[model samples]
Target: MSAVPEPAAVKTAVITGADSGIGRAAAVRLAEAGMDVGITWHTDEAGAERTAREVRERGRLAAVARMDLTRLPEAADTVDALADELGDRVDVLVNNAGTGSAVPFLDLGLDDVRRVLDVNLVGPFLCAQRAARRMIARGEGGRIVNVTSVHEHQPRVGAAPYCAAKGGLGLLTQAMALELAEHGITVNAVAPGEIATPMTGQEDTDVRTVSRPGVPLGRPGDAREAAAVIAFLAGPDASYVTGASWSVDGGMMLMGPMAGSHLTGDDWRRP
Candidate 1:
């Protein structure tokens, strides 16, 4: 692709794992903001199609591809392919694909840990590199948002591998932000807390009715809540923001000290 002047407004975005949950939300949200989007899914092509349909409904172009993060370097190529479909423009990239394990630390096997790392850390790492290179080649600034979990900052008892991967990705976001700032690129992490999504086994449930006493908001967050943050980071409004971790946790992260002292049983030890 040849270099071209940057558009005044972001035109295209590529989001990984857009088959469902936060990924799907972000895709539609970006489309609503007048951006064409390329979506990637792991094993749910039907769900991806649904997400694409929503994007197109907003009159924005949408493309879909199967991306298996476990495939490593090869899987990341999906990023370039999607950019090609978007007319060779990649203004924003959302590294939202990830996997998790609920097994205790001692019970975690080597292979399980590797799998988590591959999906959560390594895959996003490579995908961002591809998007960043394309952005640089076009001589246009870009945006990159990594969807980390609240665990990225705090630890949980049964999520050893998940925590490790998210924590690593969190730091990686900062490093990339610093290095890419010169290129007019901004990198940030959107760390989400308990959200009512398929990944949390609460798909389609009304979060307002589900009380979460531990969270100051007293309820789980909606996927759209997190997507709003991602959209802000990708849009022109957040041009000056970089290397920041925006928590969409509904104040869950603020309960660390309160939860630590109020725990009355060992139930928290199990996943």
Candidate 2:
């Protein structure tokens, strides 16, 4: 009989855009799962500090850095900075930093499209490269979870850049999974829909009291709900899962056709 190999221990993680929302929740969840954390914020330093406090309260070490993904290849250095501060090896990385635009597809300026693509797609690509290099050098397996969105699979009227970037990222996840498998690195994506978070302008609001008519669950998802899936992918339990896009959308994806069939006017066209 062959003996089973022990699952690799995840000692440290680097999470970007963790100053609020799903990123914040994922950082805390990972901390609770017994991993030191490196948190990155774009503009909300105070919010990142609060997230760090939560991680520390969980008795895990926490480090913070400012990561502006729009800065491109240079901003990705934040990943290495965080990894270095947290003991030189990143056992997990959550590329949660992103931006979106709501302009109509024809109205999007080149700069607007570029900014969205750079922040949402290019940034995660570079960060993953940096972390994967470290993981390879360390000779230990690693996990990477990219926080995409329902836009990855379906399009909204005013989200040209967002949909483009997320769709690209979803495909990137599959490519990374195939190539990284040889290095014992697993890559996956978590796509959330209508989650109550700062990104969706729902900060500090109780999700249970809000309603999402398009979602079959009848409510927007909690950031913690998405974070739970992220934490699972980062931990040993999901060791065998990779290249999969887990939708934490409360069945929103299933209602797309239903929603289209029920629209009554052109109001849906004006983001």
Candidate 3:
């Protein structure tokens, strides 16, 4: 019997915050899977370049752009610029550029809250809107994978704004999915737990082992593993799956109330 030929790759994806952490990993992994990736960085031009180099080395085209999501005025323009760089077409868009804050609710400044919302929610919404327009214009469907966090469902004591932004993003994903379904566009989210990356920078100790004992997976997730999940959702395989938030969180969310109660130290007093 004769062998069948492999299918050719068809798409280009734009990944924000591609300079580091999950963004960088997604860029590299998607490119390795034979998809061209458009990389965007907020400040780390060098880091973005490094990721772009890896993509090209893997035999995929990569286009790098500078984008500061916190600046809402530039969010749509940033997406348009990236699409232009990719020859006026984009097949997938991953909204991953976000910041973390350990600021307590009482201590959080208004500016900080706005910054988080602008970057995590507004930025992604604007970018997705722009990308969807291009996809519609080209008369082809597209995919949008929002890089949310485990905090989207679970609460973190010192991370009020972060949690709020991610939760909003989860809802936004659902909303986008419903509205875009007619156009064959899918919207989904990848909510990762504690992943080993520059953002978590806990090299000396594994927080997941000591802090998250209730989780089915004892250790923290690697950025690449999280990236693989995002890549799957971005690919054609996830066409039927939309408006869903996939938890790549070592089963943390599944641990229920007991797991959350264990993380609370407020009841413990030093008398």
- Candidate 2 residues 1-271, lDDT tens each? 2222344799999999999999999999999999999999989999999999999999999999998888878998998998888888799999999899879888889999999999999999999999999987777789999999988998888888999999999999999999888778899999998888988799878988976655667678899999999999999999899999999988778867237324344454356
Q: Judged by lDDT against the true structure, how good is candidate 3? A: 0.83
Off by over 4 Å in 2: 1-6, 257-271
**lDDT of predicted model 2:** 0.89
Clashing pairs in 2: none
Give the number of colliding residue pairs in candidate 1: 0
TM-score list, all predictions? 0.93, 0.93, 0.88
Stretches of candidate 3 exceeding 4 Å from the true structure: 1-9, 202-212, 256-271
Worst 10 residues of 3 by lDDT: 1-10
The best-first sequence of candidates by lDDT reads: 1, 2, 3
lDDT of 1 by residue, 1-271 (tens): 2333443579999999999999999999999999999999998999999999999999999999999999989999999999999999899999998889889898999999999999999999999999999988877789999999988999888788999999999999999999888788899999998888888898888998886666767778899999999999999999889999999987878876246324455455457
Worst 10 residues of 2 by lDDT: 257-266
Positional deviation of residue 93's Cα in model 3 after best superposition, in angstroms: 0.2
lDDT for position 27 in model 2: 96
The 0-to-1 C-alpha lDDT of every candidate, in the order given, reads 0.90, 0.89, 0.83
Cα deviation of 27, candidate 2, in Å: 0.2
